[model samples]
Target chain A: MTRLLLPQIGVEPPERCDAARNRRLLLDAAALLVSERGVDAVTMDAVACKAGVGKGTVFRRFGSRSGLMLALLDHSERELQQAFMFGPPPLGPGADPVERLIAYGRARIATVEVEGEVRRAAENSPGTRFSAPARAVSVTHVVSLLREAGVEGDHELLACSLLAPLEATLVLHEIRDLGMSTERLEAAWEDLVRRVTRA
Target chain B: MTRLLLPQIGVEPPERCDAARNRRLLLDAAALLVSERGVDAVTMDAVACKAGVGKGTVFRRFGSRSGLMLALLDHSERELQQAFMFGPPPLGPGADPVERLIAYGRARIATVEVEGEVRRAAENSPGTRFSAPARAVSVTHVVSLLREAGVEGDHELLACSLLAPLEATLVLHEIRDLGMSTERLEAAWEDLVRRVTRA
Candidate 1:
């Protein structure tokens, strides 16, 4: 529960349970709406109606449509980050660097494949998603794996480079505009991971 | 000798020799001005004066500053493409697939390092540069190497994935905003290429 930061001000936490429930409902409704009609059609009133919450609740939960989109993106990214960091053997702690790297990339590809539209909407919005904590988490995870693999290079740059292939814009471009298949994308990731983790 | 396309129009043949020479002069002057005072400070009349060409010649050669900037980007990308395609081994056609892939990444990093400002300007411009012949050429080269390496993935997607690391915006962000060293970038590229082309 990170406090929402505002210019020259910070909000206190200990949010009411009801208010938190309403927020969750609003986000769920918004995600449903986006899946049904894309980001453009997911209005505040519509979300409120879908969630059985008041319009004010929707607005309070996320100040605007862009804010709502950001919240959803943050939520999705956080869950994915947690899974990669602590959940399983291959993607988390116990696996070898090569296997973990492959697991990580495949996991990322699956995340993007599931949340691709929301991710694209967030990216097309003005700011902040790329610099978010989730992105930092992913970079740190990749760098750690690179070190474990004995990659004798700038691990930080290598991490960024590894993540570059997963950029929303490029992924969307490949899937939507270029008629590329997700199977192909997955295979490419496997190839990339193999090449990168080779001794 | 590729035809340059005007906005909303089909491509046209190369401009006459004299026009090309004048365009070159204007571009050189504009580059100098931009280096000294940034892209915003360079002007048509200033470029004309610096190049010892008439203002009308500058206008005729480049239509406007935006057009001139695009021409310069196209020019640089073309030269780099030519060098990699025909000039020498490693970066050129004479090297093995794995070596060529490494060279391509290194060459692209060097290109972004040298003409970085120009690449950034092009990146910030509206519309995608995917359709550019330079991009097409690079894609073709990468696809050829992927084939040569017997990589079992969609050649198009894999080539793009490999190229994702070399994107101008990402590269510039890493170097300029993150205070990353060029050595770090080159090393990362080497690591990436080795990973991408490994058997």
Candidate 2:
């Protein structure tokens, strides 16, 4: 999917260069807080303290904790999207479709390990779970790769099937509630990809 | 997968045979309301009126609207479970494992078409989604079938991947929002099963 064609979220006006930089700084601080102490530790005050900015600045930039959380998730999703769409193999342009698909699954599993709480929060609302533009983009990418790999079936539904196990909600349950390790999850995903893509 | 070993839901005291009969009557009324109108139309008053019982009887039996919805879902799940585990061929004992798995997916899609709202409501709650005993039983059944089909490598996760597309929430969205037909979804699912189980 083209970046220019992607849907814009939220109704915020365009930011000046410095304002955009400041927003990134606050989101980075919030992400660091999430990584260091979990999602609950990302209170406005904590993010403000972590970013060395006033609490008022944090609120002014993101509006609320949930807003900040959403922004952080969007930022992370865009980064992954860019890596797969443009960055080097095997997750990007240079590798075979099957290898790229495997890399995509691994990258998604890794992302969930870090941003699971945030992703689950976003998904908790029923309407947003499958309808999010980011989700659509991911599905489109997967479908493209499946077609490129010459799999002769319904690629759209096949992509959905492949992407389902990588969902944050299920992945988090498998890891936190079922106590499966990240490496094990990734290996299982790789196996699934091979099974589907093999002749 | 045995009915006797299945986890029972709710904690009401055992009902006398007559009370059990009354409860079945009430549930049948509720199911009819759901089918004829929609899930939203299955109010307590409507169920009581449909069943030719007092409104108090509906409340006494189900406690609340959500309670009635859960019971209806449980009733439906039990029926499907029985059919797959003990009833006729393809879905039950006397068919090839691959055909049984395909039958299971087709049956689940048909159920969701009828009971999507109730199933989505039950699945919306995070704590209940993956942890429900009914879900566990379904997953175990799929895993067992995959092993029976002689598919190698992470049968448990593969079963999860297969079942994810059949989830009510996602299936509902595909049918309603995306305008995909149930026939199309079932065909795609059959294709998916064949791909995963193909030698």
Candidate 3:
């Protein structure tokens, strides 16, 4: 008996699969360049060379240097989001809300250490600073955590207050301009969270 | 006895007085134009026209539009500094530290409603954002207030966190982009101050 074949629902086409892999490869190479050298070193030609792809492929994927930087920011933000949303322990679901809040601040500060330049570029643009989707998700998460901790009074505004210091622009200034250590920033954040959450 | 003395120390020469008065007049005109018509309407020609001075006088006083904006910001910030440092209670001395802190935030938010465009422009410049002398003074004031309130643990960083949300760029975003009422922001700030100071 002959059987009819059909495309699987909710599945990516083979071309899309190749496209995804290609995008991932370029981003991974860019990330490596940023880590090893710096954000300035992650040029399109460098990413293409590192990814073993043609320069045209890199350009086609990311469009421009800024486009690549934005995608890199989105990629790193998504990873952090996943960890805090689904991964185990303090940043995720298992721990108390206050602890989770502390973890969130720590995680955000850590991101500044790595992705700061890109984040600062995005922040310097007035249009993207507060309106980025990732920022909205972060605000929502902080508000929920504040509610979970039983803190009252304008949780949304409070979340904005809490997140403002962790912004890349400010954190980077503290770290780079003022010579503040990341550990000190993290400890201060923990202290802040505790104080705000104290009953 | 006739005081045949070296020019009285710290006294302006008559010609210098004229120059100072001219500068103040130009600045006041620019400020009035900004308030009545918004920042974009406060051109050099307009300031000259408003002040009843020659356009050359405005140009000679400020050099350029950016220089005028910076001077305007400096003028406004100094006024704020004076108010909080010595002007009256609630915002100045004689009030409780927490009340002063709350007043500080309210004053800053109010400034955003007026001088936000100019302040945001200054903030977007990397050199000016954190390193401005005015910011340093403001930070020192907040840190002292926190200490006076006996809130412990990283008072400097905590002050920064508290001040972050009151940044003109962020406050303007909340007021203009998100359409959040200034009253709501003020109430939320009061809530934040109480939470941080509650022991």
Candidate 4:
């Protein structure tokens, strides 16, 4: 026998657990809205309805539409972060470093295809561009991969040079303004990865 | 005989030439201010005094401070465009494609070191990002160089990826937040150029 004293020491507060679940529920609904109807259709009322919660719950969780969009972006980016860090195979682990780099860029381009508007909104600042925690994680991952692949020279800057093309702001522009396909972007990313990692 | 008739047919207007010279003079003063004390030090009053003109002249040429910054950015970018398009050797025409590409990135980094703030202001919107005439010219130049170097891939997108790191927004962040020197950036750029252009 095992005795459970976790609840007594506040291991799980019911109210907080409920709040977290509730917040995730709302975000899931918002993500669905983005995928189904696009980012422009993700109004507060629409999100509330999609989540089957009252409008007050939506407003309480996110102060405004932009706030909701930002939260949604954060959620989506975290999902991507998890995919690369811990998921499986080429994007995660158990793959060649060069292949992983290619997969990572492909995944980033896919994310931009979905959540680009939200990502671009946040990347508007030149000063804060590289300071985001997500960006740091991505850079660290790329640098480590470069080391694993036996590529020489300045890894940090090389990571940045590689990551620059995958940025949502630039990706969105390439797709919308320049009329480029994400397929083409992915192929180009692979070419870049191979070129940079070549012995 | 032909020149005598040309003046009567509205050729080389005196007022327009004076206006063009005045605009150039004010822009020159603003560029000097930028080089000496940075972009923040450039102001209507400073430019007016630096150009030995009245404040009203500066105001008449550029409607506001933001307007002045825009014009200054345009002026500087045009100068760069001219250098790469028609000027001698390395960056322009005579050098090998790979060498020209390296010089172009280095020159762009140098320009960003000086005119970065102004350039970043214009790149704020993702929609208009690749639509700028200067950006188009740069892309065309890079694509031509890639083709000339016989690099096999999507030339347009490869050019875009090559050019992404040279953007003022990313360059400024790498310098300011990441504490990277421009010299290091230039060297890394050369490495990337060689990698992409390798046979």
- Highest lDDT model number: 2
**Which prediction has more favorable DockQ, 2 or 3?**
2
lDDT of 2 by residue, B1-199 (tens): 3335544444458889999999999999988887789788999999999999999999998899989998998888888888887889799877898999999999999887678878888888898888877788798888888888888888877787888888888888888888989999999999888878988
lDDT of 1 by residue, B1-199 (tens): 1112112122358878987677677777887776677666668888888888788888877798878877777777766776766669787776777787888787777767556667766644324545555666777778877787787666887788778778777787787778887777887777677766666
DockQ of each: 0.49, 0.75, 0.68, 0.63
Score residue A91 of candidate 3 by CA lDDT: 92
Order the candidate numbers by lDDT, best to worst. Answer: 2, 3, 4, 1
**lDDT of each prediction vs. the true structure?**
0.72, 0.85, 0.84, 0.82
Cα error of candidate 2 at position B89, Å: 1.1
Q: Where does candidate 2 clash, by residue pair? A: none
For the predicted complex of model 3, DockQ is: 0.68
Which stretch of 10 consecutive residues in model 1 chain B shows the poorest summed lDDT? B1-10
Residue-by-residue lDDT tens digits, candidate 4, A1-199: 0011111111234557889999899999988887788778899999999999999999998899978876887687778776776779799777888998999999989888668867777788654466766787778788888988999999999999999998888898888887989899899999989988999
The best candidate by TM-score is 2
Query: Which is better, 1 or 2, measured by lDDT?
Result: 2
For every model shown, the clashing-pair count is 2, 0, 0, 0
Instruction: State the displacement of the C-alpha of residue B174, model 3, in Å, after optimal TM-score superposition.
Output: 0.9
Error of 2 at B173 (Å): 0.8
lDDT, candidate 2, at B183: 95
Q: What is the TM-score of each predicted model, taking all chains together?
A: 0.83, 0.92, 0.90, 0.89
The TM-score of predicted model 1 comes to 0.83
